[model samples]
Target: MAWFILIFSGAVEAVWAAALDKSAGFTRLWPSLIFLVACAISMGGLAWAMRSIPVGTAYA
Candidate 1:
């Protein structure tokens, strides 16, 4: 469901934010990779969910 993907994406966004902090300016390899991958998944999920959900409601 679109709502499920949107919620999952939002949760991943938190992981992305935390991994970004752990990345140490991208100096740390593992955390940096995690950040990059999380970013991709979060954005991709948002895009996919948007196909079924309206942008305004999804954003809210």
Candidate 2:
């Protein structure tokens, strides 16, 4: 379960990274919003997984 969350978080990280690229330094409102939301979701997933995963392993 923790590994699943960690993997899901990584996928979300990819989403946030792509959204950030589209954001163009936040010049565009929609893409920037997408980036922000994705970033939050990604971090939230990572943090959630941290409850069951060791920090070192989670990072890996």
Candidate 3:
């Protein structure tokens, strides 16, 4: 479960980056929203995964 979430989160990180780029300095509403939501999900997953996986291994 943790591994799945972690992997999903990693993939979401790419989406987050793309959204951030598409946000156009946050002037674009939809992309900005997607960026925020993706950031939250990615961070949340990373935190949750950290509870089960070692920080070093996860970071590596």
**Which residue pairs clash in candidate 2?**
none
lDDT of 1 by residue, 1-60 (tens): 889999999999999999999999999999999999999999999999999999998877
List RMSD in Å for every model shown.
Answer: 0.7, 0.8, 0.7
Off by over 4 Å in 1: none
Taking the tens digit of each residue's C-alpha lDDT, what string does model 2 give over 1-60? 878888998998999899889888999999899888988988998999999889998987
Cα lDDT over the full model 2: 0.90
Report the lDDT of model 1 for residue 18: 98
Candidate 3 residue pairs that clash: none
Residue 60 shift from truth in candidate 2, angstroms: 1.5
How does each model score on lDDT? Answer: 0.95, 0.90, 0.95
